[model samples]
Target chain A: MKLTRTGVFTIVVALAFLAVPYAATLLGSNYVITLATRVAIYAIVAVSLDMLVGRSNLVSFGHAAYFGLGGYAVAISAFHLANDVPIFGWAGTNEALIAWPLAMFVAGFGALIIGALSLRTAGVYFIMITLAFAQMLFFLFVALKYYGGDDGLSLSTRNLFAGNRITDARTFYWICLAALAICLLLSWRILNSRFGMVLRGAAASERRMAALGFPVYRYRLAAFVIAGMMAGLAGALWANQNRFVSPDMLSWVRSGEFLVMVIMGGLSSLVGPVVGAAAFLLIESYLSGWTEHWQMVFGPFVLLVAVFAPRGLWGALRGKGDV
Target chain B: MQLVLEQLLNGLQLSLTLFLLAAGLTLVFGIMGVINLAHGSLYMIGAYAGAWAAAKTGTFWLALPAGLAAAALVGAAMELLVVRRLYAREHLSQVLATFGLILFFNGFIAWSAGRSPLLMETPPQLSGFVEILPGLPYPAYRLAMMGVGVAVALGLWYMISRTRIGMLIRAGSDKREMVEALGVDIAKLFTLVFALGALLAGLAGVMVGPIRSVQVGMGEQVLITTFVVIVVGGIGSIRGAFAGALLIGMCDTLGRAFVPMLLKSWLSGPLADGLGGALSSVIIYLVMALVLIVRPRGLFPVSG
Candidate 1:
């Protein structure tokens, strides 16, 4: 493929993102580092969601179930590993590097199960069922008493990455940046692969895909699981960032927030999620200061965007959805 | 036996309320092919409107009709001003727009109502109990709700099935081109359908006000139930909505009511209580999963 103008522009934007934190570092501001870390984490989830919502045409309103499940896994595992207790004389490990894989597995597995059942139906049923299932998990977490329940569980500190490096803000931010960079690369690779084509085909014409002997359901379910696993990675970062995991992370509202990130960034583009994450967090930061009813203002803004500029911020800026 | 009867009555009452909510939702989806997430907001509007009116004048009856009217007005305005544009847009746009509306409505109402649950006291006329079939005492209001719901159901069936206008709606959903070719104005039909749908939802809200606390987010919870109802019943089918609503309402109410008792009989109190509450919450989803497995299109799928 030729190095097109849009591709170059994406590189420039990404470079800008990478340089901004360092630029802030030179200016002696730590706030940009935290914000950068958040953008990277949200980018991980947003990119994954794009596979389903943008390419596959599956509008899952319950993606938070996987994300929250992943967060809980890390939190629960860390607790057990720290406490070193077991009913059958088994102890959990506090090694988050090892625990990250476990979180991904749990989150991915949960999405696969939910998606397998939910993807059976289409249209309003699909959206509502996914939402219903997600809400079920949300309520389950709220009812679950042992691991913090409704109030959420907090870690004593952030997870360790080969010693105290994880505790350092700069080190942690770099790790998140690297992790997100790797995810973007992986997303690119997968999107260009045969599996990605199948997802796109299934999304574009499920019936045609079926007529052509392609098992559309498997492709979609695979995409859903993959997205869930990516969101799990984001969840791990969120837990480590705040050293907290709550039922709110798994709520329907969070799913809506995730969608907003995707929509604000531009649905069809890869880097749009990252850009969207930055804009949304910034908007959230300033809006919350304006009034307690920030949502009311934000809601109408979203409406205006939907009505007037359906292509979103990235799409509007780039002539050909070059995001 | 009496306890079982009461639970069944409770389930029936809940089902009646859900039927009213789902009827509008299914119709909009069927006729307009639009998913209105703010449908619940209309229910919330009805509740708050009625609550405010009833509180001011101490007249539940007056408040009920007025509340329904206000909700219908909001629904019609939504259809005309915002939702009309989304008719040809993608599901994503529709979702974003409707979701935005939900947030806007919640915040707007919260601003006005002060974020507290508004109390709706029962009217004097419908405050008593009615004994049915040997000491099975039930609230007259709930029984009246059931009666009203049944009457509405029958009225809807009569309109849609037996009337020419109803045939037009059915035709409009399945084949709009064909309906148009038959000399019917499809655009006008859509707006009318939307208004009617809102009216039903508003009535649902008004009926539900007396039983539940009228609050900002009450409709949001019930909306989830309505989704399950429409899904299990089959979109674009009123009969499907009725069956699914009653089925779901029964499962949810009975599950919540009986799970603890059933568990307590065989297990310890604390464990039973914990599992019971969790299990009850999941019952509707479980039922939906079961229905999807058996019939993906729903129990009473619409014929194209």
Candidate 2:
């Protein structure tokens, strides 16, 4: 594992992520730490999505359904826990550890239902259906008047851990860093496990894998659930960081932004999604400072890459070596 | 009942608008094999251009063709500049690239025209309603939309199904190699088809301007519905697109109008309203899901 390129790369990146926060404290680079924090969250989501998108070759347009649902779970949970409302009378925890896992469950469950129906579709139909499912979820959230609806929900405070002050910046950063590490490790293990091997073979050649006795559909659904859990993790962190959860988190546009991160960073490569998320956030932050309509400039530029450099950022950097 | 008749007319009007968008979208998918998520952006552009023109000249007639032309021209340029290069990429790349176009276009329009809906006045000739039944009447503009939509559909059918060029499109869908073997300029045919599709989308946008206010990001809401229609109708199938468009239009409108009323009759009013509103919005998607379950290739898949 240590010798493998992905493993080595992961270690180096993880070290940098750790070193950056400490360095931020030393050098007073809170901005950089904050930026890295966002990158870490987005990367978790992107890597999880790669499980389905890259490993299984299931292009989902509704991955945001989990993301938005995860945020809602945290928000709604906080609402109930703070008000001392029971889960139909059972006490709820206001802590993120419990809330985070619960959010993951809700997100994963939703993905399970959507993927079951959508995975049955392939090619163009598959794309549109997945997209439509995501949009449907988006609309549902938008239409709900109970929890901020279109306006969104804002938490009074970040979710607390059992004994730790999660409100502390450096502490929160380390906690996020640990979560990211666990997520990446889990993703890598899943891809290399026996299950992972079968999944990849199915992606490369679904028909051949089926003929060889693999239940391709189940693997794809499992991958989708895995991906949804990852996105839910991000959404949970995002809610804590921003203390807000809105339909915007689950929009098709936001989903598209994730796709951009995956592509610009390098699709099919584990490190690519992380790198892409970092670069995208950094660039967009800088560009938006210069002009309000930076998207007009940036949009075509990204399109140029998609059109001309289909290999994406990672692909362009490593060439055939990465693939 | 007059309510049913009126809803049918509204549905027909809506169907024509959808047909325009769907026809262009499905053709691009069928012939070029690229998912232009920004097809809606092109639709948006047409609306913007036409609205700008109508606002400037104070004449809806002149603005109509100007919008159509502007969209067609932009479509050609887009085909030449960006869309052409994306033909061989994976659908994800297409989705991303076009999505970028959406962001760009939305921002560009906002910067240039401000983020407000542009109001276009309807022409006097098309603004009146005529009595159809003893006590019921329909808006003339909606009737005109149905007429124009039917005419355009017929024109497209004739062009594709009855003309020499039509044979090329039929061949192009299934046997591009064969069409190229026949010494036809296949590249030109592609450009023509893309341009035609763009023109139709533009026509839809321009015609829709009179019905509602034109604004930024309007293309997005419509784009999804059009995609639904294409999926239900079967990509690359014109007749299927038409039928799917009408079915979707009717289901969407009637679902919105009557679902809550029906639900109220069965359940308590408040619960019915809450769930009904949500269910009404999902009616089209529900219809689509059922259709796909039965006919995965869509209701009227083009043989090609």
Candidate 3:
């Protein structure tokens, strides 16, 4: 039960996140709350990606597919609920308990199918194939006219939590914070378990793990599904954040940004992705506010990070063998 | 039949353009073991440079070399400045660093050139149509592009197979250490290969500019498709790239041209249209997936 340095750091960061709404009230602006909620949601997705990139040695360039699917799940459910129509013998409900899990399930199912195929190839092929599948899904959503197509779909209202609709930015921020906390704890538990060891082992050398009778493919696929579901939850929260869902959410660029966050945050730990997500969004927001051409500065900054800070900000702070 | 023929020609034109892009991408990946996400930016630079030159000079001829030179110079600078440091890095770092380069280049281009799309007119003589068959007339400019593509492919084949540099390139990809041990400056060879790849990308950008509007972020759209091409073709295999490009271009063009019509024959209007549009757009990806399932190494993997 003793607190390590990282444990203490985590507590401080958590406390800081909890104080955001109070700070926003003092500042007389809700912008920070909204931005924090976004960071929290993105953190969920980025952490899930780290499970693959950092733990399993699988670098998926299409993790956004699940996120977008999760968002669309919420949007589509809301769409059907508003229309008073039954889809597949069930009436749509705006209950967060129902819609949120549905989003995660849909995203997990998508990962299952994509993973089944993509896992057949390794290295560059795996990366490109995953990307292609994500693009395929993006196009599918874009071409679906009923759900708003290229223009995207808007939710009628925020989903009710336990029969009460959550209103206001502070409330949403707390909910997102709670979700991120639960995800982090669950990820921490899973990564430390024996299964986590096997996953890490498979990543280190798939051949060795398979030879040891670990069923490497199944473990990787399981990890992929879990990560997909986590990202899906983030995507669902994201949809509710804006009350909208767009094909742009599933774009390759978004996927790339997620990768950058995982790498920039520090790889292979529960805390890294959250740190990376916060850093990425804050820097992006700050830079854009300074000038219209923010990417010109941000791009070089990323390059400099890659060249000089290969271990990422967190890893650098933690020093050697930190992960 | 006439429609099919016209679509076929269109497919070929698109295929050749993709081939030009794919060749450079595959070459760089095959030889240097680098996954450069900014290869498309070099293409953009080419198109932008060519478009600017053509606008200023009132001639497309000057634009060709202008595009090539600019792309080569920028590409060389990129190699020396950024990619040189990435030679020994892992693929993830390489992907991120190059991805950063993409963001910088795109933002820089938009900032410097204005965000509006730039137009490049087809050269006067080739702007007109040519009668290939008694009833089938095609744009002469497109025909000219095909000719250029064929010529480049042949030239590439000759250079890779017939010249001393070609021998070095072949040797370099196969055994970098051995080549270096034999007194070849592997670093210089890498830069040359990278510049060569950039030059080809630039040429593709210039050729495609007159066909499609020259604009920021256009490289990304083509870059993904080029990735598909390289994946479908064996990575680093020139023959595979050509084959993959042709397969993807023809499938995509033909699917887009005919899928809706075919769907309309059997289904209702809106559903058919939507389904067909979606299916056609994803057909190439499906093709890639199928290829991976059947042949995980792609159609012509060069490594083993």
Candidate 4:
């Protein structure tokens, strides 16, 4: 209810992000709108990952597995529906209302299975197991020749958004922005609630939380599912944006990229991920424009940020105490 | 019968390669408490160096030392410049920093090497097949690799159990502060251990370069499997690494060769192939999961 400096800054930033499409239109550059949409989609994933990495003290190296699962869900369903074929005895539907929620549930279910097994261990084991599970899923998809396999599944058009034409870049961008804003708001509420406090307490000291009678595993599992579903939502949007889905979407490299965004944005803050995603995309665009080997420049830049700017761009901008 | 024997040999070769990489990884991780995602880059560097040297000199013998020296030098420089700062940091920071290093090395290698896999030729002296048993012949190069792996394993065991630096390394793993208090330059010791690990990884990369494509990202593929080895073997134990590598190598190689054939009786050819391929690829991960369920600390956890 009361406006703090952090709150005010967040609102201004959100407004500026919402205004990007209009500005891009005014400048007659639809490419900018599309790029901004990508940043927003990736921001959704980074924030979801932050719930695990930042708040829950669970550093998953396989978040991309869920994200990719979400994308595959949409692509597979759309493919089946287009061909009038039943997938595993069930008729596929292209309805966004049906497909998107199904995608979320599928990803959440995947998280449930993976988390149940991976959560049995802590520290480095958890990271490697998650990575291994994701790689398994990646290989599974790669071997599925029925789903286009390594070439990836392509959709003729974006999934219909309640009968609205999402083919328009501006319309799609607004949809992605809305999704990001809603996820951010939901995450903010979750982090402030009692459940979030328990999660944070567990992160700080798992043994202490357990001593205090908290079922740490269950809470952590809940957070993992929530984060996975949120990332899955982002994946659905990403699939729509690109009009394709591939094994690359679920690769360990993508998971690393998601982690990089969270770290580069400032791990402790809520809005840091969005800022990180934006900065990453913008820098990538500019660097790629300069040379074919942009990763040579981009990789070292990330290293510089990790080493020198431990506070990240947002933390530095907010100064010392704000985070 | 011959096919099974050949697959077993393949498994042995694969296991030895993994042992070389995992032994180094487990050592660095056990002693420094740093999870290095860029260790794979050291493997890639060794492969490139060896490939380049072998091509220039037209001799495999020169390439061996060239790869080891290159990897050791790079590993030492990396330790001094970047890794030393990460020793006191959290695992997340270490993961991120090392990940950045991976990207840098991969991109740098691609840029320098022109994005194509380089070719390495096995020396003629080690190219022919040799009889290992009655009616069973194996590639001499692969046999030589197994011999080297066994020799190195014995050498490592002796070094760790008998030498002064090995004593320091063992002590440091147990208690870093106490080792420093004993007036040992812990930093130099860490650098040396890290360089040694890198040297072993280089040895692996150069030896396997002729067998596999010497490409930019090859290190990453093997790196993940090496992690699986260390995890299943018990993190810091070299003996565990060796045992885990052999187990995984056998499981992977045998599964790939036999699973589809077994499935062929019940399923269509293409479907069985797909399922078998998928199952075989994930067999090690499944093994890792089961191991963690049974022994979360791994089979041979070294007490720290």
DockQ of 3: 0.78
Off by over 4 Å in 4: A1-3
DockQ of each: 0.64, 0.68, 0.78, 0.71
lDDT of 1 by residue, A206-225 (tens): 89989999888888888899
- Model 4, A92-162: lDDT tens digits are 87777788898899999999999998898888878888888888899889988789889999987888889
TM-score (chain A only) for the predictions, listed in order:
0.95, 0.94, 0.97, 0.97
Per-residue CA lDDT of model 1 for B1-304, tens digit only, reads: 8999999999998898899989999999888889888899999898888888998888998898888899889988999899999989887888888888888888888877878787888888989999987878789999999999999999999999999889999888988888989889888788888888888888988888888888877877888889999999998789999999999999999998897788889988666777877788888889998999999889999865
Pairs that collide, model 4: none
Q: Candidate 2 lDDT, tens digit per residue, A126-202?
A: 88888888888887777676677789998888998885669877777777778888888898798789889988898
Q: Is the docking of candidate 2 incorrect, acceptable, medium or high quality?
A: medium
Model 4 fnat?
A: 0.52
Interface RMSD of 3: 1.0
Q: Residues A274-308, candidate 3, lDDT per residue (tens digit)?
A: 99999999999999999999999999988988887
Return the TM-score for each candidate structure. Answer: 0.96, 0.96, 0.98, 0.98
Model 2 regions more than 4 Å off:
A1-11, A27-29, A83-93, B302-304
Ranking by DockQ: 3, 4, 2, 1
Candidate 2 lDDT by residue in tens digits, B117-203: 988888889788889788897888788888999999999889988999988888888888889998999888888888988898888
lDDT tens per residue, model 4, B1-304: 9999999999988998899999899989988988888889999999999999999999999999999999999999999999999899888888888888888898899889878889999989999999988999999999999999888888888988899988988889999999999899999999999999999999999999888899988988888889889989988888899999998888888988888788887998688878877787788888988888898878898774
